[model samples]
Target chain A: MSVLTLEDVNSYYGNSHILFDLDLEVEQNEVVALLGRNGAGKTTTLRTITGTVPRREGRIEFRGEDIADDSVDKISNRGVKLVPEERRIFPTLTVTENMQVARDMSSGNPRDIQEMYDVFPVLDELRENRGRNLSGGEQQMLSVARALIQDPDLLLLDEPTEGLAPVIVDDLYDVLSEVVAEDVTVVITEQNVDFALELSERAYIIEKGANAWGGTVDELNEREDLLDEYLSVGGAEAD
Target chain B: MVSLGLVFDQLITGLTIGARLFLIAVGLSLIFGVLDVLNFAHGVLYMIGAYAALWAIGAVSIPFIGLLGIGFWPGLVVAILAAGLVGVLIEAGFIRRVYDREPLDQLLLTFAFVLMLTDVVKTTFGSGSNVVDPPGLLAGSLTLTSSLSLPNYRAFVILMSIVVLAAIFVVLQTTNVGRLVRATSSDRDMAALLGVNVPRLYTVVFFVGAALAGLGGALAVPTQSITPALGNQVIINAFVIAVIGGLGSFAGAFVGAYLVGISIAVGSLIVAGAGQLIPFIAMIVVLLLKPEGLFGGAEA
Candidate 1:
């Protein structure tokens, strides 16, 4: 029941090798988190799976089909949506327009707009406001809402909680919990250890560009030395 | 007191020229904004449109159900369609390859297309300047003042351009397709993640942009000289307008067209040959003052 599997995947940026023999998997409706400090290849792993970062070697399978050579748009067509770290929202477009455009691009009957509004009422209140006018937290919400409207079978979120207020991060955690309840498989990369552990069922600690270790969230919580050496702190919100 | 009538005449002339410039420059701006491709062949697309209209009307005329051959209107339609189709083909065949290449590579690729397109037109139509009469409905002059008169065709061109502008605005602002276009133009990577087929969208945008340029060329038939170098003649000025307005900016193109057009018109009035230099000066001034161009701060 593995919805996505990246086996011994290697990725590069120009000549510099980024991800090295990275291995990961997400099961049906499973919530998995990739945790590491900056430059640990967590983001690159998510990108490789989404086909944004070209994998130099190994296999990436989604729904039991290899997708290592598939184009970014093609992978997206197979219901893989990525909310990147930068939260690249169209600043000139209104909030509603951003979500509507995503919904229009996806196949099948449109997801109910009311459901989106209900999930993020702040988005509804600022529906007519342009993307540039939104605060950082609001932009993050809009970015996440855009991906959600696509109704993807596999959601890839990279650093969704990066640079957000603790309160906003808590709100995002709540929204994502609701999303998980809807049975969409998610693979999120995070530097905030507590936040990642709070949402994900399992954790993979990435060291440099390869997988260092992975186990259940409870198992990760028990390994204080492993967390300290890779994630910079033994406990708490150490990135 | 001399008279305000001459000034009115010049204003009307300026508007006509601005409308034509807007047509060519808007497409250039759109292409740059979305695809990040500086299409040098856009001017040639305009030239192709002019030549296509001429050939459609005079050389190879299509027989209507009842009429013997096609007229100027049908020829104009053909010219637009031909230019748009050619744009799509070029985008798919040549420009698409350079999207991921260096900026210089893209410029060189498009510049090569320009040279090839120019030679093709020269070979097909000969290098000599030609003329095509305006449609009968627009074949006269309208007397706007006691001493001022406007060519009916120029008036028609201005009005038609306004309608096209309104349509473009409506499509980009108030429609779902426009939202997708805006989204794609804003961030292609993000749009792709949203499941937008960006390559196909790019092709459509290039087609629309080329078609607009072609329409401008067709409209110029009765007003401007038809020659192989016609594209070379107006393209620099069009680039200046796009730069002054801001590359990839709709409102920038709109305002830049008029700024350049009116400067040329009024400059001609003040000094003999200053009209030619005015647009460049305006471009330099805009660049020095606001490096992003007037409307280039963000894509619309």
Candidate 2:
């Protein structure tokens, strides 16, 4: 069964229609990437699933249960967790304390902290540092680690490599690859098409809140004209 | 010999007054931090507590010390529960809808509530300033001598406050629920996304915060008069302490209470009725330098 499914979803912010008949699904353990240019509602889709962006209409089913109107907490407790776009780490809390807050909330195993430290060794090195003190790459990693503490089944990552140095991006992607390999379903939204192309099993291109194109990663690579036409990336289709 | 004794006497006096401030300021601070609601009616809750304690004493028709286990303990428990219930009702009927609304709206609503509560209590209890003296067993002065002595009740109030503050500190520092309180206060929306039952936590915090305020008032009954305007004096004074400590900071509130309490106590010793001005002045200075608070960051 798919871990998450958005069936004929429609959402609006005030009078502005932001999402229109959005249909998507993520099978368990698959890495699906939503790639788009700015204002394409890439972030909104993730937020809607997370319930950070309010839902006006649609069925958001998780693990075969209908939880369309449930609050973010309930949805999260059911195992879908979102790592927000800006990496909303608690500025006032230390890295360890941030982990502790998540630990306090859920049935987190004590051993998970060690596993998280292993996932991001840099975080272990800076465990005592305040969230505000971490660099962008470090904060992104910490954000992921924070979500892991919740023991989520489906992890929604928003722009995990937005402003990292090349080496840091490499490190982050390596961590992402390792995580996705371990039976955790990941849906990453990125402006970095190359990473999405290489890492994701399936890809969707959205424009102004609706899916413009979707295909398997190999099929997506074959459609160079599709990329140029929909994603505005130069013709991988023609090439 | 007398002068040295009086200084010791004054130090003891400072602790009693500090307890009263602790009861008032921390209540306001907790509600302000978690609900982001200033609870203008806190003084009214205090007044209710004092009056309720008075009622417990009379209604039970028992000796005062006997009242501690019987009238006093039961009365205190009832007072906290009743006040906490009222806080929940107010939040449910009015506050929940206005969470995303402006603070000014909440301020006006709570202010109106203060007026309603004060008038209601005044009408029911009458405007008379009722006082409950220490029970005879606890009444006699503890000697610094033939001329000077301290009432055992006031000393008890001080000791009880230290115990209460210690308990509050332990709960906030160590408990899981307390951590949830801090999380919600720090970021309500973020807390919700993280799977915290935010609305439920909101109601619970409001109840507990109100209960503390009410308990403070009830505990103060033996020492002060129970009048309609009692909440007014309590709120104004607590606001100063809350500001001095940094709004919503539990630790800051605790220290602020003692500091402001000491300031007022010392002020009254020399300046008489004008000592209250010290808190106002201290509040203004703290506001100027540390707007976020003494320990916390800028208010969200």
Candidate 3:
């Protein structure tokens, strides 16, 4: 059975409609990349899944149970966690405190705090630092580690590599690679096509709030026409 | 020449007043820090607390604890419970509706509550002022020197405020609920996504904040008169203190309260009729120098 399935989902922000009849499915322990251009409703889809959108309709099933009308915290407690695009770390809280929050609130059996530090050794070094004091790379690591400590069944990463340097992106890729190896189900949304393709097995392309195309990573790599039509990779191709 | 003993006496008096102000202002600061709502009804909660304490003292009598006679201790407990209950209702029933509204709308709503609650107090307790005497155990003064003496009640207020401040610090720094509060105050949406029940937390915070105001009012019963307009008068000073300390900073409130208290005490001695103007002047100076207040960085 699929870990998460969204069928004909419709979402709105106030009167402005953002998603229309969006259908998606993720198998257990599968790595899926949601690819889209800016404002193509990629983030909105993640927001809808987490119940953060102001209003949403249609079926969102996790572990075969419908969660369409559940509150954000309820959905999260059921083991669906989103690492938001902005990496909303509590600036006043220390690194350990940030992880402790997720652990305290986690409904599932949480990973021990020491284990999180072991996975992200850099965080162990900066354990005493406040969230605002960390570098971009460190904050991203902490954001992911914080979610991972909750031991979420399905992890959602929204633009995790949005504002990092090449070296930092490489570091995050390694961390996420280890997380995936632990048999954790993952879904990622990214503008970095190379990074997304490298980390995901299958991919879905969304355009104008609707699914544009979906196939295996190899199939997507061969389809240059679809890439040009849906993505801004035309500029990268010229370079 | 102004004697050193006189200055010492004024300092102690200033601390007592600051202690009272801290009880009221810290609640205002906490509510704003977490809910991002300026509760104009906060003062009314304080007023309710004072009235509840007065009523409790008059109505309840226990011989065993009569050492602090006239139900002073019982009144304090009743005052806290009454104020906290009312605060919970205000947040769950009324303030929750305006969470997504504009600041002006929130202000108007709370201001409406202030008017209504004040009237309710007027009808229930009568418009005339009332007073509660200090418990017999705290009815005397402690002579420190030839010209220096501290009223036992004032000393009690000061000691109690210190204990409350310590408790607040420990809870905010060490407890799970405190960590959640800090997390929520910084980013509401993020906290929600992490499984923190934001709405329920708001109610809990409102209760704590309201209880603090009640505690402040109950403590004030021995020092000041209670009236329907008392909340309106104290709330203005509380706002000034919160602003001076920075709107969401607990440490700032602590320091700011004492600063205002000292200014009032010392200013009265140095310049006649100038004590009233000193706090405002200090506020202007602080605002001009640091618009975010003395310790404004992150919420809570």
Candidate 4:
């Protein structure tokens, strides 16, 4: 069953159009990657689903409910969690406090604090540390852990592996792969093709606010010209 | 060195005044922090609180509260609740519409509220000085040292201010709701995505800020005379304190209030107009030395 679907979504900042006729879908337990270079509407597409984009024209269905007109908080309460590109951690708050703020109390979320620590043991070490004190990798882990604490069914992560060391990326891939095991659908936007392909089963290449291609990771690996045309990355050998 | 007794006396006086300033300025800082709006009408709330207390105490009797024997404590309580209610109305009726607009727009809108409030006070109480006698327990002075005789009301105001400060600190620092507020203040959009009701939070913040202003006004009624333009005279100093401490910082407000209070208390002893000039001078110096004020970091 499709867990999330966006049909002909168009988003804009004032008069400047960012997403044009963007259509995407994710099945239950699937990992989907929205791949594009900078300013190609990948982030905007995720933001549209999260209801952060101000001017959005489209139909967004999460599970079976249409959430096109819902406010950001209402959309979030419906179990759609977005770990934004900025991460948006409260710099003044401790790591545990950050996680606590996103707890899904409405669903009586069974995910405990220790469960989150089990996923990112680094968070356990830095539990009392404030968000401002965390390193980039630690911040990313905390960001993902915070969303996980919400026990969301559909997790929208923007540029999860950006500016991270390979080892940290590997660790994150392991954590998310485990999350995917529990039937949670994840839609991630990325410029890192290797990282995206490693986690995502299906990939959609968005170019200039429209869908350029949609296929499996294997199909994307064979099309060097498609990668070069859309992502500015050379090909499979680029990784 | 100057006599230690004289310095001690001035310090006590500074603290009493600082307590009142903290009450007003902290609310200003909090409103700015969470709402990202500079409320020029905050001073007007202070003015309303003073008048409300005066009405409650039978100093100036309107139709509703003048006939009752609502003494000092009840009067102050009424003033705070009334001011907070007015704030809720203002935030819902006016400020909510301008939340996403420019700061200039918010400023002008709040400034309009200030004018309207001032006019309402003038129409109701007339343009005369209204004084509220201290409560019976706080009316007299208690002699401390040979030269240190503290007015009981002033001491009470200072002590009460400390209690309020501690309460606010505990609320913002320790509670779950406080955590939500702090998170919202850091990033409104992110807070919403975490299922925080941002609009309701904004209203609560506005109400709390207004209530603090009202409490400050009621406290000031015993120490100073209430005039329609009392808000105008005090607001500039409150802004100076908020800026000198950092616009949205709680600790900054606490320290900045004392700095401005002590400077004014000490400066007035030296020169004729130094009390007024020192606060502005301190603000300029702080701006020159630490552009973000003492406690302000990257958020400034």
Best candidate per TM-score, number?
3
The positional error of residue A57 in candidate 1, measured at the CA in angstroms, is 2.6
lDDT of 2 by residue, B143-252 (tens): 86775788897878777767777877777657777666766777777777778888888888788878887788777877776778988887888888777778877777
Instruction: Pick the winner on DockQ between candidates 2 and 3.
Output: 3
Residue pairs with colliding backbones in model 2 are: A224-A236, A224-A237, A225-A237, B43-B231, B67-B72
For residues A97-153, write the lDDT of model 4, one tens digit per residue. Answer: 998788733243647889999889989999999999998899999999988888888
What would you estimate as the lDDT of candidate 4? 0.87
TM-score of 4: 0.93
lDDT of 3 by residue, A124-204 (tens): 999889999999889999999999999999999999999899999998999899998887999999999889899899999
Judging by lDDT, tell me the better candidate of 1 and 2.
1
| Candidate 2 lDDT by residue in tens digits, A33-64 | 99877778888898888787754588988898
- Residue range with the least summed lDDT across 10 consecutive positions in model 2 chain B: B60-69
Question: What 10-residue stretch in candidate 3 chain A is worst by lDDT?
Answer: A230-239
How would you order the candidates by lDDT, starting with the best? 3, 4, 1, 2
Model 4 lDDT tens row, B232-277: 8778888999879998988888888888888888777778568879
Better of 3 and 4 by lDDT: 3
The reply for model 1, stretches above 4 Å from the true place, is A235-239, B1-11, B59-69
Going through the candidates in order, what is the number of backbone clashes in each? 0, 5, 0, 0
In the range B1-300, model 1's lDDT, one tens digit per residue, is 335776776677788778888999999988988899998888899999888887766743223422223668997898899999999999988899889999899988888878998988887677888776788988889986678888888889889878877888899988989888888998899888887889999999999999999999888887777887888877898899988988888888888888887788767777878987999998999889987899878655
Question: Which ranking of candidates, highest DockQ first?
Answer: 3, 1, 4, 2
Candidate 1 lDDT over A1-239, as tens digits, reads 89998898899988889988888988999999998888898888888888887446798999999998988889998999999999998898999888889888886455877789999998999989999999889999989888888888998899999899999999999998888888799999988778878888998999989989989999988988888888887455443
Total residue pair clashes for candidate 1? 0
Top-DockQ structure, candidate number: 3
